[model samples]
Target: MAQLSWAAPSAQALLAASDAVRNPDQSFGLINNLIEYRDGKQIDSSTLAVYARADRKTGQFRNLIRFVAPQRDAGKLLLKNGNDLWFFDPSSKASVRITPQQRLLGQAANGDVMTVNLAGDYDASIGAEEEIQDGERQKRASYRLDLTAKNNEVTYHRIEYWLDRNNSRPIKAKFYSNSDRLLKTAYYRHFQTSLGQERPTETVIIDGLDPKWITVMRLSDWAYREVPESWFQRDYLPRFNPEQAQ
Candidate 1:
């Protein structure tokens, strides 16, 4: 008997697989903790609860990020519907348009927290396969992927992503601006079983211009929940009930 020969997976397949390793397929919620550091000293931190669901028509995730900690910021929400993003404050009861490029913390951008489907929004091409250092500083053999945004609404104009060749797990990524300037570098690590997949639980992001500026994002308490379509609308921001988020 002879073994069957097959061709390698396409770049798109690899990208989609990588996305699967990072995102859940169904409606879900998770706790996101952002810890900002500078020169190895902790400077700031934020806790957020993120509820997300993919749109049936576009396959893009609609996210409602609610601030959970830091009393001054609680009850605030950041809504990401398709390409539009808005910041809503309960105190003022006002919705203000915001851009993804805006920095949320030291090294974390507003776009970074939004639930996004990379494969659904970008064009991908295969790059070199090489040995690289992962988040844990361990040597890993990885495949490089070059991605360009399909539209202007995306967070980054371009991205260079590295995935574990053997498992298609995302190891690291470099984000770029429209002018091709490197904006940030993120390393995905601490994978754990969440909502049926081995998803990355922590992300270490380093500032493009300053190595000392670092933001560590940790995600936890993953669960499949009911995310209603009304939650994605700006008009429902004021009416959103926290108990329903549970």
Candidate 2:
């Protein structure tokens, strides 16, 4: 029952590994995400095109999401500036403040679809190590990471993250609230080469309270792109040209 304390080098390597899985590009990138929600027997899905740019100084990702599916949601936009997130509905012609905790559809939140690098927002320690079978039924040694939020900006207050000991590929994660209540569990799988790096293609999240409810986010079409500085400005939301995004 002895507790495990991670070494500084191991912790840094783990952080870098998690960041690599989340966003591989050293600077800027874009990806398409398809999200699906399931509750019992009911299922629903949405598609989004996301553009992400990293702040060289802070290492924070500035993301812009454009809904691209189900005619009704088309043209809607979500912008993330630091810790704050904003949603703009083309029909309403207004911008409203939103939080990462808010559900975008069903079980998935806005933060789940955005490009996030956990190393910047979390202070991680290796809490334990275990042997486990991955999605492909491959046995591997893995490290279970205990992560504490460095600040209030992150989506989850605390997290239990698991990653392969050899390659630093994330295997699973459990998200928790400030009160230490379990919120959800996510399994990372379907590793594919994107933007010249292999990363998880799908993240499947199951509700903590209702295990039958599940949400999935699929990432694809990753490309290294140039993101203009003007894109991160709040004033650009209204005038953000969808045509320019493509």
Candidate 3:
């Protein structure tokens, strides 16, 4: 694995620069609502509400949403405390508590799918810089980053990210399998700042495994506030938080 070096402007630098520029206030908390669409039709919709107080803060997230369409009665919940991750699925009434290793694996999987930056978990290298669109307006000084997972067991081999160089925000991401085949791609269409962080408001996930199965996420009416740390505990997952269980 390659370390992000300042001398050559590594991929991490580009990402950090983007984060700093887009989120000048440096607020770390955010809440997002996501909608998943397939074949130009609405198939599923959900909300990925998130909150982050700081870089290493515990109990920094909450994902509350109903996954409807392909699966009628499915809901997924994820809570993170620093390096720990807790995943809960309402349909199965099952919860999986993840260690640091598992957390890395989960982030790796998500990093492959979404253009959203995963802070310092995986090593990334800057590939190229170009100009792209932010909505209909054209922006210059965008960077391309190559992210490779340190763990070999994960499905994705490498990911290419096109980020806005001025702000280091990702506009598009391409994932490839171990055999160098394209796996999936995500496009970020809208962005907003909450808790001083720039997060995508509209996103699309195209699955290579099943091209027909496209997942779209849209964030709206975001609210940021303090949430109980205990909400992230695996043991408490079954209880469900009334505020988060819409």
- Top candidate (lDDT): 1
lDDT of 3 at 186: 72
Candidate 2 residue runs with Cα over 4 Å from true position? 1-9, 27-31, 35-42
User: Model 3 off-target regions past 4 Å?
Assistant: 1-8, 19-31, 51-76, 81-86, 89-93, 97-117, 132-140, 152-157, 196-199, 209-213, 244-246
List residue ranges in candidate 1 displaced over 4 A. Answer: 1-7
| Tens digits of lDDT, candidate 3, 1-246 | 234335556667676665453332222333344445556676545434444333334212222222333344345656554445556778688977643223122112332222223434446877766666554356645667888866663335677878865556668877776788886777776677644566666656676676666666555554444545555556777786545633
Error of 2 at 39 (Å): 5.6
Q: Using lDDT as the measure, name the better of candidate 1 and candidate 2.
A: 1
lDDT of 2 by residue, 52-107 (tens): 88888887888888888878899999989888898998887798988898888667
What lDDT does candidate 1 reach at residue 23?
87
Estimate, for each residue in 1-246, the C-alpha lDDT of model 1 and write its tens digit.
122224546778999999888888899999999999999999999999999999999888999999988889988999999889999999999999999999988888999998888999899987777789999999988888899999898899999999998999999999999999999899999999998889899999999999899999999999998898899999999998777876
Best first by lDDT, ranked: 1, 2, 3
For all the candidates, what are their Cα RMSDs to the real structure?
3.7, 2.3, 6.1
Candidate 3 differs from the real structure by a C-alpha RMSD in angstroms, to one decimal, of: 6.1
lDDT of the candidates, in the order given: 0.91, 0.80, 0.53
TM-score of 3: 0.66
